[model samples]
Target: MTDIQLNMDGEPGWEPFDAPALVGASLRFVSGDRTGNRFRMRYFRNASGELVARVWFGPETEGPPGHAHGGSIAAVLDEVLGLAAWAAGYPIVVGNLNIHFRHLLPLQTVVQVDSEVVAAAGRKISVRGRIVLGDRIFAEADCLCITLPEEQRRQLG
Candidate 1:
């Protein structure tokens, strides 16, 4: 394991991301799980204008000894990728999530999640993302999201 410094605050080339009012209030499953209490996510836009998140996997996310649980990693990917779609002007709900875990993420370390909107066709939006620590990749995901009906979206808000 390489020694990596964790910075909770915003770093250079990244700006803080404020979740839209409704999404911030309605998000409760993974991003706001009280029992899991596994992550602290700070959203940002990198210099190139891609969606990014800095996430800290806390102690409660442990699964394999000192590493973060697979579920935790998946949750982060789900939310960040969905948000990436939203940032790209799509109103969506994740229809399917496919994640590949490459390495065990150490607990209490801050990792970067970089996301991009890849495609859009009718109601479907495709987004790709990854969780990385310096040069190491912990996980990567491809998400398929379905745009919500305008009426249903209003109901969510």
Candidate 2:
């Protein structure tokens, strides 16, 4: 039997990050199933402390034959981008996510999601991210997030 690769914390220069620690089960829809075939996601922080994710789109996420659905891709972006804000110490909820699909993503392929917190203005935070495999960019998104109030933030956790 072949073992499924479910986690990536041991990769060089990457550290394991627990999103559930911050938001409880709020991110469960996209990233919750670690062993399921729908989506397999492993969260990490690179050497620079930037949030990154290794995500696999399984057969259940397919739209076109052999390819993943655009909605599936967008959902991953929404979760990761919003988590990017939380990882950067801003407890936030995604208000808007603008995505541009550049290429079709094949199901069962692992791709990297790299995210950055670009700007912050009072209660608002902007995050930019991409789903890519090496030099090939599959999708890119800019997420607008709003900082949650202290009470609301505590409730999320």
Candidate 3:
């Protein structure tokens, strides 16, 4: 097993997210799975308050050759983009997720995911995000999220 070193202190213009606060709260499936060990994700918020995540694709996520699986990439996009909506103050669940893969991501590589809430109309929210390694974009995603009903939100809380 390879040792993964993470900078717990976030990158410039961003702040580390409190993952424990979200576990079992809104992101149970993704953030609460401690045993699968497919990825190590660190969340942050940019200076403009957009949600961002720095992710390390672990060996457990391998697919074609030494690259990360497409499904793993999509999972990251789903969680990051969904949390982006929540960070924007919309209690939401993903209604639709569309991802375009631009390049193959290598396993064990740390990548940056940047997300922003693009539009909001009533209960529907549109978010755009991308996974990148420096100047190269690995994938881009657009997500439509639906706000949970007040009753459901209260039940979750």
lDDT to native, each model? 0.84, 0.90, 0.84
lDDT for each residue of candidate 1 in 4-77, tens digit (9 for 90 to 100) = 32465567888778755527665665556433457777778888888898888889889999999999899889
Clashing pairs in 2: none
**Runs in model 1 lying further than 4 Å from the true structure:** 1-6, 20-22, 33-37
Q: Cα miss at 20, model 3 (Å)?
A: 4.0
Q: Best-fitting candidate, measured by TM-score?
A: 2
- Per-residue lDDT of model 2, residues 19-121, tens digit only: 8887788778999988788898888999989899999899999999999999999999999999999999999889999999999999888899999999999
TM per prediction: 0.88, 0.93, 0.89
Candidate 3 ranges with C-alpha deviation above 4 Å: 1-3, 6-9, 23-28, 33-37
RMSD of each: 3.6, 1.8, 2.5
lDDT of model 2 at position 40: 84
Estimate the overall C-alpha local distance difference test score of candidate 3: 0.84
Q: What is the lDDT of residue 23 in candidate 1?
A: 71
Candidate 3 lDDT, 1-157, residue by residue in tens:
3345453246787887875576355566555554345787778888888888888887888989899999999999999998888877898999999999999999888888999999999999999999998899999999999999999999878
Candidate maximizing lDDT:
2
